[model samples]
Target: MSRPHILAVAKLVPLLLDQLHTAYVVHDRVHEASPEEFAKVASNIRAIVGGGESKVTRALMNQLLALELISIMGVGYAGVDVAAAVERDVPVTHTPGVLNDEVADLAIGLMLSIARRIPQADQYVRAGRWGKEGAMPLTRKVSGARLGIVGLGRIGQAIAKRAEAFGMSIAYTARSAKPDLTHTYYPTATALAEQVDFLIVITPGGAETRHLINAEVLAALGSKGYLINVARGSVVDEAALVEALKDGVIAGAALDVFEKEPHPSEALWTMDNVVLTPHIASATWQTRQAMADLAAGNLHAHFAGEKLLSPVPECN
Candidate 1:
């Protein structure tokens, strides 16, 4: 049997599949297989898919479908047109299990950083501002803080596990309650935010959640709450957030994701109370490699007539 053709669209994490001797299929390029290129390896082409959702759209998707399966590697297949793929009878897969611990670690880190003003303090001391300052709002105690989790998925559970070490009281708002968890459940997000010293968003991104953490929610937390988002940037209102941080509507925020990709509002740049990082909550080397391997495992299973390892049944 001939080798199954695979195209790695995700630019950040390279495919580490040892089972297949593969070549790179750069999606940004206009042609991975042109007339001359196709003529050389036309018969060898089988499957093609990009890393991010938009990476493989109309033409690329159609070409990949004409052959065999087009497997996607990451949990967010916001790129794969599942309805279209289903209509075309193409099997789609993603890597879901690997990044949980990494994301959870980031959640805890961001929460602690925001609560303690770690990043700002670092900047102040490095810039010699501490020499003239009265008292640089030192780190806060995580031991007795109230922790609010926005989503109660696997990553949320992982974060909760980490919080146990800090001796935090956990409270969460899930669409549906998990009977197994002894953690307190609040009927509304406002209730959760109201009760916690820190609010950590672990929810998924999309329209339903767009601007979920807005002025009203921030106001509900009062001036003592800290917001940490390891989720999507769109989940919170960036403009409102800037104003909140500036006016002290909320104590502070620790963000791993932002409204704009690679660009946050300039107004948020210098706030001593805020801690902002590029969207890298799940970017650990070990975790990303595991994700890649798991994605490949799904593809390997699918072609071998085995069950798919992780499949997104429907988008929520």
Candidate 2:
């Protein structure tokens, strides 16, 4: 039998690509194909593989007449138009649990980076400023501080568990209170921010959560508090965050993701109180490989007439 033709929206890890090559004829990238070439093979494309940020727009999916699935290599799939996929009876799968620990680890890392001024201290030492200018200024303590988690989902819970090791008091704000959770619950983000020394954002990204952490939340966090975002960038208002950091509305912020990726706001780049990473919370080798395995397994399962390993909940 002929191999299924699949479109690769973004180049995946070599290991996953090797596995995919064994069962499918993979096209390199959608945009790379010539107009006539794409049209010729569009109807035969059975699936698409992408990272969390890949765009599987309605226009693109409409071209794939036989598109059976979209396999996302990471936990976040906000880039994929889930509504469009559901309308066409196509299911979407994402590697969720595999990267939870890595993301959570980064969340805690960001919290420490901000509160303790690790990045700034390192830069100070590297520049020989420590030798010339005496001791760096003291920074806030991380241990035993109040921690407010903005979204207590899987990754959020993981962050909470890690925070416990530091003896931090934990509180949370979610869409609705979780019955099993014993931590203090706040109905609103502003309410949660008001009482915590650190407010970590580990929420999912979507229209509902866009700018959920805005000026009001930042103001509530106060000048003594810090913000850590290991979740989607859109979940926090970048403009508000910049203003807060500049105006001392909040003490500092450490962010793994940004509203504009690979192009975070220029204002944040020079700010000493802010730390920025290029959306690499789940960039560790082990976690990325596990995520790749799960994503590939989901695609393989779909083609083999078996249950998908990790279909996004919305698909169900």
Candidate 3:
């Protein structure tokens, strides 16, 4: 039998690419191929694979008549047209649990980096300002602070667990309250923001949650509160966040993801209070390797007639 043809839509890690290439005939970025070129191999493609941020639009899926599964190497699949996949009876799978700890670790790290001004302090020392300028300015404390989490999913719960070690009083706002947990639950983001010292966004990204954190929520967080986002960039309004940071509507922001990605607002670059990362929450070698295994495992299982390892929530 011929090896199954798979389409890769995003730039994936070499480990995953190696695994896919070893087991299947893979086409890299067929979406960018000319129409005539795409038509040549589209009919033979049986699967699609990409990173979390890959765009698997309906138009692309429509071209692959043989597409059976979409294996996303990252936890977030907001860019994938899941609704259209469901309509076409194509299951979407993502590497989720493997990344929870890595992302949670980054969230806590960012919290400390921003609140304690760790990055700035490093710069202060590197520039030899600590000796000449006297001691650096005192920064906020993270221990025993009030924390509000938007979205109490597995990753959110992981972040909460980490915050607990710091003695943070945790509250959360989700689609609905999680009755099993003892933490306080607010009905809305604004309500949660009003009472917390740090508002961390971990919600899923999509149309439903686009700009869930806007000017009002930032206002509710107040000038003394901080914002940390380890979720999708679209979940928070970038424009409002820029204005808030500039105007001191909130104390500071530490972001792993951004609205445009690889490019955030130019206004944020010079702000001492804002700490930005190039979306490296799950970038660790161990976590990324695990994710690669899971993503490839899904494809292997599907072809082998075994059950999928981790289908996205909608598909499950």
Give me the candidate number with maximum TM-score.
3
Minimal lDDT window, size 10, model 1 = 24-33
User: Per-residue lDDT tens digits of candidate 2, residues 1-316?
Assistant: 8999999998788868988999999987955657778888899999999998888999999989899999999888988999999999999999998888999998998888888889999999999999999998889999999999999999999999999999999999999999898999999999999999999998889889999999999999999999999888899999999999999999999999899888899999999999888888988889888987998899889999999999899987
Number of backbone clashes in candidate 3: 0
The lDDT ranking, best first, is 3, 2, 1
Candidate 1 TM-score, true structure as reference: 0.85
- Estimate the lDDT of model 3: 0.94
Deviation from native of the Cα of residue 311 in model 1, angstroms: 1.7
In model 2, which residue pairs have backbone atoms overlapping below 3 Å?
none
- What is the lDDT of every predicted structure here? 0.75, 0.92, 0.94
lDDT tens digits by residue: candidate 3, 15-38: 899999999999888668666777
- Which has the higher TM-score value, candidate number 1 or candidate number 3? 3
Q: Candidates 1 and 2: which is better by lDDT? A: 2
Off by over 4 Å in 2: none
Superposed Cα deviation of residue 285, candidate 3 (Å): 0.3
Q: Pick the candidate with the highest lDDT.
A: 3
